[model samples]
Target chain A: MADHLSEPFKKSAMTNEEIMKTQREMRIQFIAFAFMIALTFLAFIAVGAEVAPPGFVISFIIFLAFIQLFLQLYYFMHLKDKDHGWANTFMVSGLVLSIPTIVALILIIGVVKY
Target chain B: MSETVDVSRGLPAHPERATLEGKNKFVGFWVFLSGEVTMFATFFGTYLGLRNGTAGGPEAADLFHMPLVFIMTMILLTSSLTSVIAITAMKKNQFKKMKLWMWITFFLGVAFLGFEIYEFVEYVHYGLGFSTSAFASSFYSLVGLHGAHVVFGLGWVLLLLIRYNRAGITLTNAPKFYMFSLYWHFIDVVWVFIFTVVYLMGIGGG
Candidate 1:
């Protein structure tokens, strides 16, 4: 129903046709990447010690890592809001399924219950 | 993207390149990435288990050399950025610019390979030979495979650069440039994991 209602971009919203990433934008994006990486390293240092449980710290870092990953994908990898449906679907599936399946296996194998 | 002036305008023939060239590369890349995800997933599982194993020998905390890995990571990541710049250059039809960036990218990749070779040499010297234990096997295999990919990617980029040095940015070479950039980025993604799982998480001794 919604599909019928929605216009097929009758004249699909034309893009600015401005070529990708101006020099200024590219420079800024690179700087932002550097900053995010620095923050990730800082996170590395923060969790360097025996702070919380190992898993807790790792999960926290991974949460932060995901943000950086998304930033890179959106800005650098160019999978921004303008992407097609398949890219989004594939990414979402990877994020949703890989975590549970992999983590569950790790838990099962490493628990060491006699 | 072929246009035919065949006065037969009744029904246009849309010859779709199987694998959809661009979409094919995209999907094929994803399929390859699936294998990668599964590969890394297995390593994560083993890493979690053996992380505690430490083989009663040594832990990640003692072994991690952050500076070396940090620089290596920086090189790989920087290559990702430059490759994109190359892609961007291609879109604007700047053949020379694309080649320059790709060449720069190629050199950076070689630098990364040099560092990896050195890192492995150091590991062996430090008595962390791959045959030492399960820990060493997984360690070398996972990280080394990534390094090998980088080496492989470097070769691919070099070949493209040489072959297309003068061809300029035609529609034909556009996809090739685009796919290389994709590969370069994927390698960076995998490195983020190596840094986290093998280096960072591996640090702190499990």
Candidate 2:
């Protein structure tokens, strides 16, 4: 079984360190995956169960969303890797530029109509 | 070429960022994604502002159902995982597994789109036409644009799979695949916001 499984990785250089690194990454991936699922459930519960105040529920879900997006960018997209400096720079700039625009839009649209 | 291509052993630790070509593509795509960030923020801002301007039509609180959006979120999130697994397979030079996982990601995307279409139809049935009010227009603008991205991503992944089917894992194709995964992850990130700002908030769960 081991011999058969090893065939696919034979074409690549499978050093012990690289293999260990991949194993560690896989473990982290599963953990992140599980945590994301749990977070989703909690968001649903916050709304469905009405355990918290209405205002608090909204903030709570948005906070959970922040965590999920961070994981998606840093872990899944590999943005946290050492070599991703320029990518990091661009993404940060994008975030910075968008915040003011979002706030201006909110102000212009005016929430009183709703 | 100054450097010969190594077709024998596996790729470097960061295969997609290993070569000059790879680095260029990787950095360029991030710049493009940054622009995308601003574009999407505009849409989200518009939607958030106008979400209640229903012109006496159906408001978001009356229109959105949490369960459907929740299911769609789970599907898209799972697709992100599948794409990550595909890249892992690529790092190991396991081309077949990479293809399989990418296909899984594609189909999951297709499923998510299906649900989205259904939701839009249900909304329209409930007197929420795009031209119905300011709220409806912005809703379509924000969420519909995202759906369009999913459609484009599906086509891009399929083209990559077919183009590289018989070529094996070359330096040229590795960066292409890596970029595709990054794009997929970005789509997932956008959905994270959509679920929070749009769905959760619309449902008064926030």
Candidate 3:
């Protein structure tokens, strides 16, 4: 078993259906990539063109950032697939914790100055 | 365990997690990544809190060049895609294609790092030193942490490529490559927030 791990294989175990599924997955990934790029561009344009007030633009870009984040995490990272329940749990918890951390730091450090 | 993975049938569709060791690594890496999230959150919080504390030094609005940052964002984003492709190739047992895509990802990472270095140097010349102000210190630490990750990731993939130059699609290396892809994507995730919160907000007059 140990020796087999280091040796190379001549072919893949993927059946024809699995191969077709993988190809389909790749196409979906490409579409996700395109959406991410569009989101990025829109964020940049919003800031560049000054299409709205600074407050509105800031919120808009941050919203776009969140959308990009979901796309990357779900599609690119495969967090949307089955068998990712634990991965999803850990990541979502981390994200939940982050919000309070950021809010506290901004309110306490930036505003309160304690 | 022996019956579960029959090597004579060729590489598995999910080679990375076919073995118990590989499965453990997969889960462990995600745990570590969760910790990294909080770690980076602290830095992000610090930067946001102190961004307005320029203290007579160069501010974000003046120091950041939109075009340069936009280019860097594009480079990093594209590299993320390339690594995704590489991992997809890995799962498909296309060893040569996987290596090729990984190499492409490495070069793109190097290009992104180069721009980051150039951006930092330009900022220093513009008088935004590490100790120039609260903003400067926090900004450097946050962005610099991300840059260090890029450098580390580059070294990692390079070593993997060199060590496994001739080792075809083996179960042992599959998990390693897959984990690297995840790390690379996380870096891009961090950069997403960096650009939106730091660069965009900086130039947007917030």
Best candidate (score: TM-score) = 3
Please report how far candidate 3 places residue B82 from its true position, in Å. Answer: 0.7
**Looking at the true structure's interface, with contacts defined as alpha carbon pairs within 8 Å between chains A and B, what fraction does model 3 recover?**
0.74
What is the Cα-based lDDT of residue A36 in candidate 1?
64
- For residue B184, model 3's alpha carbon misses the true position, in angstroms, by 0.2
Best-fitting candidate, measured by lDDT?
3
Interface RMSD of each: 9.9, 5.5, 1.3
Give lDDT tens digits, candidate 3, residues B64-106: 8899999999999999999999998998889999999999999
Residue-wise C-alpha lDDT for candidate 1, range A28-112, written one tens digit per residue: 6778678667856765775665678877877776766666677666677666634335655665576566677667756776666
Model 1 has a DockQ score of 0.17
lDDT of 3 by residue, A42-87 (tens): 9999999986999999999999999998999999989999888889
Off by over 4 Å in 1: A1-17, A20-28, A47-57, A81-83, B1-20
Chain A alone, TM-score per model: 0.62, 0.84, 0.95
Q: What lDDT is reached at residue B18 by model 3?
A: 87
Alpha carbon lDDT at B175, candidate 2: 89
- Which ranking of candidates, highest TM-score first? 3, 2, 1
For B66-158, candidate 1 gives per-residue lDDT tens digits of 788888888877888788788766655566787999998999999998998998897787787777756677777778888888988988998
- The DockQ of predicted model 2 stands at 0.40
